[model samples]
Structure formats: C-alpha cells, structure tokens
Target: MSKSRIFLFLMLCFIGGVALRSLVFIGSFYLWFLFGVLTIAVFSFSRNRTALLYAALIAVTIAGALWYGRFVPEHLALERFVGQEAAREGSIVKDPEFKNTTQRLVVSFPEAPSERVLVVARRYPEFGYGDIVRVSGTLEKPEPFDGFNYSAYLAKDSVYFTVSFANVALVKEGSGFARGLFALKRKFEENINAALSSPQSAFANGVLLGDTSGISKELNDAFIATGMSHITALSGYNITVMLIFTHLLLAQLLLPRTVVFWASVGIVAAFVVMTGASPSVVRAALMGLALLLARHLGREGSVLHILVFAACAMIVVNPRILAFDVGFQLSFLAVLGLAYIAPWLEAKLKRIPEAFKLKESFVATVSAQAAVLPLLLYQFHQVSLIAPLTNVLVLPLMPFVMLFGFAVGALGFVSYHAALAVAYPLWLALSYQLGVIHYFSQFSYAQIAF
Candidate 1:
C-alpha cells in the first residue's frame, strides 16, 4: 500500500468495474452510497492522508461516471420517440461526416440537451458545426448487426436515436471556435483536392488529414485487404507518427528542443481537432504530451506513472469509453504494446534487413497487430495476411508523404503555383503507394474474413 502505484492500480480496477457495471444499468444511488461508506471506513484505518486525498477524488469521479451513464432524464432514452413520424428542432452540435452515399450529423436540442441524436441525410446542402435546423423524419434506433452491438456503439457517444434523410431547414449558421475549426478543415480539404486527383488526392488527404470520405471503395478496400487501412483512419499509430514528425520538423527550424517539443504538442492538438478528435487520437495525444512533460523534467522513470495517470484521467472523463468505445481500447493497447513489447520485437528482428527501415517497420506492424489482433478480430472479423509485407513497403514513406502533403495543402493558402509544384513529387509518392495497395489487394490471400 505504501507504493505510489498501489493506489493507481486500485483506482484503475475501481473505475473499470464501475464503468462495466454502468453498461447494464446496474448503478444506483444506493450502490454509490454503500461504496462510498466502505471506502471511507477502510481508509479510516490508514494514516496515509495523501492516499486518502487521491482515493476521495477517484471515488467522486467514478460516482459521477456511473450516474451519467445509468441515470439520465427519461426523455433522453430511445423510448421518447413514440411513433415513426416526428419533427424536432435542434442545432447541429458536431461536424457532419460526409461520405459518398450519405451525410451524418449529430443534432442536439437547444435547451439543455442531455443527449445527441444522429441525423443521416442526403449528400446535398451540407451542414457544418453549430447550425440551427428543423429536422423531420422517422426516428429509428441502430440495431445489432453481424453480432455487433450497434446500439451500444452509438450510445458511447450519447446518440440514442437516428433520423434518415428528411427535410432539413437551416435556421442559422454557426459561429465561434467550433465553426472556425470546421471552416479551416474545409479549406484544407479544398486545398488537397486542388493539388491532387482521384485516389491520389484521396490518399494524400488520408495521409495529411485523415480525410477518407473521398476515397473510392475500390481504393479503400485495397488498403483494407493489405492491412493498411489503419494508416488512413489516422489511428493512434498515425497520430504518434504525426507528433514525432512535427517535433522533428520544428526542431529543424532552429527552435530550442523544449520550445519545439511544446509546439509539437500544440500542433498535434490542432491536428486532433481537425480530424474530429476521436478517442484514440485524443488518448495518444495526451499520453504523448505526458511523456514530453516527463522528458522535459529530465526524469524518464516517471513515464510509467504518467501513462497510468493519463489513462485514468481519460477513462474518468468518459467512462462509457472503457466499455463501449473500440477506439479507446485499440488506442491504449497499441501504445501499451509499443512501450512494453516493441523493443523486444525490434531487437529480435535486428538480424532482418534494415533497408528503408524495413525491419523496424515490420516489427512495429507485428507488435501492434499482436496487441490489438484479438479485439480487431472480434470487432472487424477480418485479418490481413499481407500486413507485414505491405507495412514494410509503405511505412518508411509515411513521414515524408505526410510532411509533403501538409506542405502542399498549406502552400495552397498562400500560393497556388507553389502548391502545384509540390503536388508533382507528392503525386509520385502517392502513385507508388496506390500501386502497392492495388497490387496487394488483387491477391486473394491478402486477408481472411471470419
């Protein structure tokens, strides 16, 4: 109990249990009260005031998380929609996700909305963040599909109901920082489109901004067949690579390492915002920042503590994620694997080729696959057989593609000629990438579906 990590481990177990209990509506005020008393009575026998303080804060957080998940207003439930036809007025609270066939937006009531609803509409007359609108349609709850709990999946984001394409009337446009963030994202996407074409622009957008909606099913399926889809989603691995590239790029500009380090954190923060701030990216960014802080303090041994602390904080912030969000699970496990297992794998593979960092890239792909394979199989039901080969071929070029793509997109804001010039080399890299994916996808052995 004297160990600093003892409290941390206990907190993790407590939070995990509480979040699990929340899923089935198992939490009540009585459970919270009894748990509080038991915790206090146990701590009463100890003299560790610091531990007491930590435990108290943790207890409160778990209590809140339990309450939020299990006890909300009745209107927030899916039962609120008594019939199929209904009309509701709310504001678009999240950025709309535009795909080839549909546009999905999350709308919430203007007056103290306790929950958000997913609005699926046609891919026309687009809506951005923070637009007041009147929606008319039949409300339907997502159903389980292919053994997947689609309802629980949407519940993780507090989305309880969905409305298909209906008449959507805009009441007003958005303002403030949320609006500005989406606006900037739209501009950046336009720039990428201006510089590249079809699958090239699609690949470059995915590399630079995690914009995969533009990618055709053929190209996307190709990446999936090759086990390269993770790169396009901008998962934790991609975010980690982006952060490291930003740090190196800043350092090369003659900035002090400390300044460059913090700036990189800021840049990653901005990137997360631009990419819709999924739990995986946010978790990776926070953990990366925590490590940066530990290094800045000149004590690397504290990294483990910082990692645990950051995970706990994120879990407490969104307790539902612990149980429902696959992104959170994959993100944390991926980093955990890299931190604890990649070194051993890297050493074992050192006898392998180092050309274009092929050995390291292959090992990284293997280590991450080892860590997340079980979850991926359960969730996605497909495993890529050619993942190692494809990773070795493509990973070494990732940093460069992302850098040049960002440059070309940014330069478009200032100079079109410069953007076009940069696009040529960017095009070459993307063409090679597209070629590799297309070639691998043709092999029936590339992936196995369960």
Candidate 2:
C-alpha cells in the first residue's frame, strides 16, 4: 500500500480500538498483554511484509485501546468524593452558562486540576472565567436521565462531579490571557445586547460568538424543533462558512494566497479562543485548518483523510470524546455527510434551481440531516421532520446573519448609533430566520417523537 493508504489504515484501526474500549470495557492488563503479543507478532512476521503490516496495524489498534484505558481510572477517581458536602476552592474553567434563573459553571479545583465539577448556582451572583470560587454542596455524579448518557457527556470534558444549588463565593477575580479573552467576550455580548433587542440580539450573539446563554427557552425550543439549533452552537458548518468568507474577503484585498491563508487561520484561532475553545469548535477548527494547509501545500487532500486526521488527533488527546461528546459526534457526522453524501446528493438533485445557491444548500442540508438522523433519534428520542426544509431556508442566510451580527457587535464597541446602522440588516436576517423557525415549528408534524 502507498504511504497515505498505510497511514489512513493505521489511523482507522486506532480509532476502532478507541471505540472498542468505549463500547466494551477492557482492563489495562489485557490491553498491555495484547500490545505485547502484537509486538511479538510483528517481530516474528518481519520476514513477511504482508504479515508484518497486519501485525503493525494490530499493534496500533492495541495502542489506541491502551490510550483510552489510561484515562478510565482518572474518570473514576472523583467518585469517592460523591455524596459528600464539601467546600472546595476551584477556578471557573468555562464561562458560566445561564438558562433562565440558573447559571451553570464548570469549575476545576487545584487539588484535582484535570477533573472538573459542574456547579449550579443562582444567576445573580455571576462568575466569570478563571474566577477562584469556593463551592459548598453535595457532590454527585451526573445520572443518565431521559435516555441521555449525561455522565458520559460530562465525562468527555473531565467533568465527573456535579454540585447543585451550590453556595459559591468568589475568592478572587480572574486574571490572565483566558480571563482577558472572556472579558472581551463579555464586552462583545454587551455590545450586541445594546444594539439589538431580546431574542434577536440573543440569536445574533449565538451565531456571531456561540454565546447561547442569552437565548430564551422558547426560542431555543423552536430552534431544536426546526433542527436549526446548530446555528446557535458553533459547528463545522459555521466554521467552514467563516473560513470561506474570510478567505474570499481577504483575497479581494489582493493579498498573496499565503498571507490570506495565514490571516484566515489567525482569525479562526481568535474566534475559537473567543468562543472558549469548546471541543466541538476545536474539532471543526482543526479540520478547517487541515483543509487550509492542504490548499496552501497545493495538494488535493482527500476530505475523508482530512476529517479522519482531525478526529484522530483529537481522540489521541481526549479519547473519551469519541463516544461521550454528542457535539463531537454530530460535528463529525455532519462533515462526513458533506464530504461523502453531499456530492452524491448534488448529482441526483439536478434540476433543483441553482439560484441563490438554493440547490447547493438543499443538498448539504439533506446530506447532513440524513447522516445525523440515526444519532439524533438515539440521543434525543425525536427527529425533526422539517429539518431539511428549515435548514434549506435558513442555511443560505446564515453567512449573512453571522457577518452582520459580528459587524454590529464589534461596531457597538465604538458607537451605539454606528452599530444600529449595521444591525438593521442583521435584524432583518434574524427576523426571517426566526419567522421560518416559528412558522415551521408550529406544524404538529415539525418533529416526531418515539
């Protein structure tokens, strides 16, 4: 096999090993033993090239299993502290997520810096990222409820403990690059709010910065029913659009391709940081970066290869994410659909009007929704029957919505009046999107439940 083929095979084997562990528990000793056996088999088969390749691939697979096995113990380490009421000092690692009257904070203690605890507190006592807080509450592991593996979901982030209605006190205000980034993010959010009204401003923030904290439950439910919630949560689709927009806009300035690529990468990196670099965004960014690298190198990189490389790179860092993070799963599947299914769909979708890129958007929406259908049903217990229609209506406007929203938010920092001028187009875009969501969501058959 060619070098690229060999590399792809090994990567796939490694991912299989990691997924195998996720589905079936294999002890460390067994994994290590398998690794040793594979090593011996490789040596024994050294005289036979084919046998050696097979042995090597098996070894790589075992390595993946071992990689995943290493983290299993750390996942269980926090269980000991469950059921105890304790006050622990920790820094808020992520921006607090506010929903209605409650704010959820992911705090990491110095004692166990790698592990995190989700603290649920009142929305009034706002805590920013990196704030050192003392939390007092009964520590509990998240239970799998409503057919959701909530524990596994949290486990993907090393968040193994939960503290409900916690007595949280800020011991010290945060300071550092992360804190500064968050402060900037908060300022942007304030600017957005000042420029636009509730729900619309909230939607703007969601698309522009992946800040869904301001989105209302009713609007949120509408998005969910319409299968448009991914717009609010940054995903591969948004990143792809942003990257393309950046490249084209920068290209118009007559910059060299190298300069444009690097500048786009920098902007995306900044966007990722501003969005707190959640795993899903990071995954999407990695893939986007990979594509940029391929284009820069003048190589026609395979999309499947790029996708696999990005995923394996992430799984190597945090194996649990492969199985536990729903966002990662959705992002991967969506892109996988774009890479493989979308082209087939495009060919079959001939005769769909190409005006306004409707044909392109329709193919993408159908492919992605189809790819993620099984996972959605398994995870959420419902399917958006109107997903393709709603996505087709909204996807085309997303780039404009994001651009205008971002422009208004950034302009708000300089002048409220200046921001309002930009906000008009953004308002119109959001109104249309919200209208589509509301109009489609009202249908009884918009979504179907098991």
Best by lDDT: 2
What digit string (tens of lDDT, one per residue) describes model 2 on residues 369-450? 6676677667767789988788778876765676577677677778999999998888888888899999998888888777
**Would you list the C-alpha lDDT of every candidate in the order shown?**
0.72, 0.79
Total clashes in model 2, counting residue pairs 3 or more apart in sequence or in different chains: 0
RMSD of each: 3.8, 2.7
lDDT of 1 by residue, 1-450 (tens): 557766566666666655656565654665678677859765785687766766665665556556455533455544657357877889988778889878898999754476778898888888889898888888787888888788777877778777877678788888888688778778878888998887799888776666688888888889889988777765565555455545655766898878887788777776667555645567767765765566667766666677677777876676667777776676666665555566688787677766654454455545655676677667767888887788768776676677678778778889988999998998998999889889989998889988
What is candidate 1's local distance difference test score?
0.72
Error of 2 at 354 (Å): 6.6
- Clash count for candidate 1 is 0
> How close to the true structure is residue 186 of candidate 1, measured as C-alpha lDDT?
82
